[model samples]
Target: MGTADTFIKNRLDERKASGIYRMLKPENSLVDFCSNDYLGFARSAMLKNNIVAEMAHYPDSLNGSTGSRLLSGNLKYAEELEQQIAIFHEAEAGLLFNSGYDANVGLFSSLPQKGHAIICDELIHASIIDGARLSHANRYTFRHNDLESLEGKLKQAKGNCYVVIESVYSMDGDTPPILGILQLTERYNANLIVDEAHAVGLYPAGLISELGLQNRIFARIVTFGKALGCHGAVVLGSNLLREYLINFARSFVYTTAASFHQLASVKMAYELLKEVDDEANVLRNYIFLFKQKLNNNSQYKLLPSDSAIQCIVVNSNGNAKHVSGQLQAAGLDVRAILSPTVATGTERIRICMHSFNTLEQVKLLTSTLNTITHAQ
Candidate 1:
């Protein structure tokens, strides 16, 4: 009907030509190596039962959040849950968001003043990148996990500065040198924000708590959908930050408050995390096993990470897809991380290990992968 239609179609065609086009497929019934259900809570019937038990405790809780938190959507006991979350994480206060993306959008979109600066790692999540893009502050991206590069950018920062990074990067699964970066940010008089999306339940209290550096940094973003096995996220900071975001963060101000069911699910998930405190160690065992098996394979160039997400670079989108397809055919549901998502040369087959995954399953997955590499 218009030039806009033709332009949009051309962009779609370009994606196809570039070997980066994507579409959602039905959930694979293969082995459990592709999901973010790091602890198998998504597949746990006990969690669902716990949700029902939790809902029973809140008779007055509504079927749906009627409006934004500013209006009718504020449910009884919601603030109590927020406080519980804060206490659990050893933070002064907590504010909930519908999802990690919404939280990032709200936080960065609102925080940076006109003369302030937001410096983020280049490989930080797209949500943070989008949020920084929306801000009026001078934004800069340092090389991923390169503290020296971060300092270089910080040297040119104008006003109040915020340094953003993930505790555990989602793509490569490697953790940044958090203490070193924290020292750098402190030296520069900058606030540090850590996205603990993948490291929430993986550490003792968190990476911060495990490092014995609680309340030293500015804020920690914790998401429940991954390790906690539920939906929603929270910003852990001071009460003043909570009040400020409630007032100014557009995503929080304009969106409907999280439903009681979602909030209760978060609560119950934490209860499960505490009840099964040894699960993190169990996950570490799998990571160790996978790495140990891949040892001495001179041709295998898997990324160095101590986390559940293990990536093997395939160099090209075509090759990554082909290898992933071979694995999937062997009954593993691994996925390929393509270019545009990652750099062209760093395209990979991302194998996500879970706590519930069996030792035999891990063995089979590695064996299949090793077979593929040998064929290549």
Candidate 2:
């Protein structure tokens, strides 16, 4: 092999030996327990039909955006959809990005300037961390969900301090005390940016809006891929902030705009979200059932969360992988979150409960988990 190939193979071999190698698996027919489709909109026949119908309204639309937004790809319909979404979420304005990763990366990287501060929760998403890394700002991370820790970081911040956090943490599936965090940010005069990727469809317009804090937050990132079951994301803030990102955020400025059909899907998803309060309730019920099955059982260590994303810590790479494998073998779809995605001893099987998951399915998942973890 060539020298580069040798180096690549050695690095991959190290990952394999360390039990952290990754591979993409084909879709299977197992019971759903490991997807971000909290509201089942991704799998909804109604949603599919609505999107198809909506696309029919724009018969001459392009199959794909010809170029980036600044080039030949900007569409009037895209901006209209952005306004509709922003208004629905009670924001002054909004700007769309291709996906949640793009939104977070674009917002975090471009907003904070040199000598400014970007303070994030230690458990913030990898995209945010990467975005912060690309910025010229001084970066710091507080202990996850710790108000005191965040306050300490805020005090150390310099110019144009921005505090970043997720409304629903992906791995832990828990929410920070948002009000407390917001109060601290206000006191410190820091800009609070919340990523509501996992909380969007489940909470009407997301946690900030649900709490009537839409006008209070500096900026909010709402993703469509998770509960909304669509393909893009939007950053909601002031009209000035939207304009700033359009000019300064490289991810949004350089990437091709989303296609007509993708935009149609997003629009359709939001309409469906308005009608799915019942489904949202069903999702909450399933979450409760899953937690009840565990019942603080000493055998399984389930993290505390009210969100659809639930984690059961198994404490090692080997244990987490084995438990996840056993779960998949039992006709349940579950995946392991191994280090260094999480800390070494905090590796877990991340269980995602959806509105369409039946009661029997939840029972089987918890029972199977009990059996496997007890066997350990």
**Per-residue lDDT of 269 in model 2:** 93
- What value does the lDDT take at residue 101 in candidate 2? 92
RMSD of each candidate relative to the true structure: 1.4, 1.1
State the TM-score for model 2: 0.98
Top-TM-score candidate index: 2
State the C-alpha lDDT per candidate. 0.89, 0.92
lDDT of 1 at 217: 80
| After superposition, candidate 1 runs with Cα above 4 Å error | 295-300, 374-376
Using lDDT, give the best candidate's number. Answer: 2
In angstroms, give how far residue 290 of model 1 lies from its true place: 0.5
In Å, residue 140's CA in model 2 sits off its true spot by 0.4
With a 3 Å backbone cut-off (N, CA, C), the pairs that clash in candidate 1 are none
